[model samples]
Target: MCNYGGGLGKSLKPFVEYNEPGKIMIIETPQSKSAQLSACWGPIESARAKVRGAEGVIVSGNVRQVDQFQDAGLPVLSRGIAALGPREYMRLGSVNETLAIGGLKVDPDDILLADDDGVVVVRQQELSQVIESCEYGVKHDEVVLQAIAEGSTMKEAWRKAYDLLGPPVEYARPFRR
Candidate 1:
């Protein structure tokens, strides 16, 4: 992940070099005392990163070239888009350090699972437990699916799942308050 201001430095070579299979690039530019613009990269930069083997990019700020990025099949998540480029305003920020992203402290090598549903990060230390929970969830849902397939109503199948698997797990912050 990278923390930068509105301007993207002259080169994004470092980020491209760091890109590897199974790795996702996450960028953040929080609201600052300035105009608070977060301009990291546009579609062209996104394509470059993808070509270098980045699985996807998650931007906490704005990006440009939306249509091109989407057509290229490079997964990109951003708050919005802008016409401005980073030629004048870009600067190199911190990389591979703990960063505050969407109220979460993200670390290097953490597992990021993002989809239409949303994005979730599993710290490296809790990976095993998270995987086990995911496995259990898949199996539990399978039973509900089977019941629905067997002519049970959606509500009925869900009730059966609750009875069999117990209540859904409650949310808990990864770190202590």
Candidate 2:
């Protein structure tokens, strides 16, 4: 019953094109009543990729479309899927509404970062700052992981993990047309 039709069905591109080398993480805004739906659908449309061309779809509420979304190789991160469609529960709700997902409040146009590890929501204003912090964290963690990989003791690696930060800067969303 759930749909991967509409824009959700197509390849999502805006996210893919916009995110570039970085992976796009979609944090769904939560729903009050049926929290499970939010676990897949969240409460908004922004989290659902445009369905034409997208980096991936991360369902905060609950997501269906296993065969549809999966067959296309669409990058979908979902808590789970139900056979019921949106019409079964709600209808005519517009896109771009504020959403709560995974216990996080996600606004429209917030910066979402993700990878094999998982997802993180960077507030619109804090996006750049977070990237700066995370980039440094990533580099340092790499070194630490490398040391451990090279037969270094866990204690030593842990000790060396400190002060591995680079300059702390800000994360600003680029001005769009």
Using Cα atoms with residue i matched to residue i, what is each candidate's TM-score against the true structure?
Answer: 0.77, 0.58
**Runs off by more than 4 Å, candidate 1:** 6-14, 33-38, 87-90, 145-155, 163-177
- Strongest candidate by TM-score: 1
Off by over 4 Å in 2: 1-51, 163-177
Write the residue-wise lDDT of candidate 2 on 1-177 in tens digits.
122223343322232234333334453423445544432342233334433345666665456546554545446666667655443333222245455554566665667665556767677676567767768778767878988998889877766766454343444433322
Error of 2 at 143 (Å): 1.8
Q: Rate the local accuracy (lDDT) of all candidates.
A: 0.72, 0.51
Model 1 has how many clashing residue pairs?
3
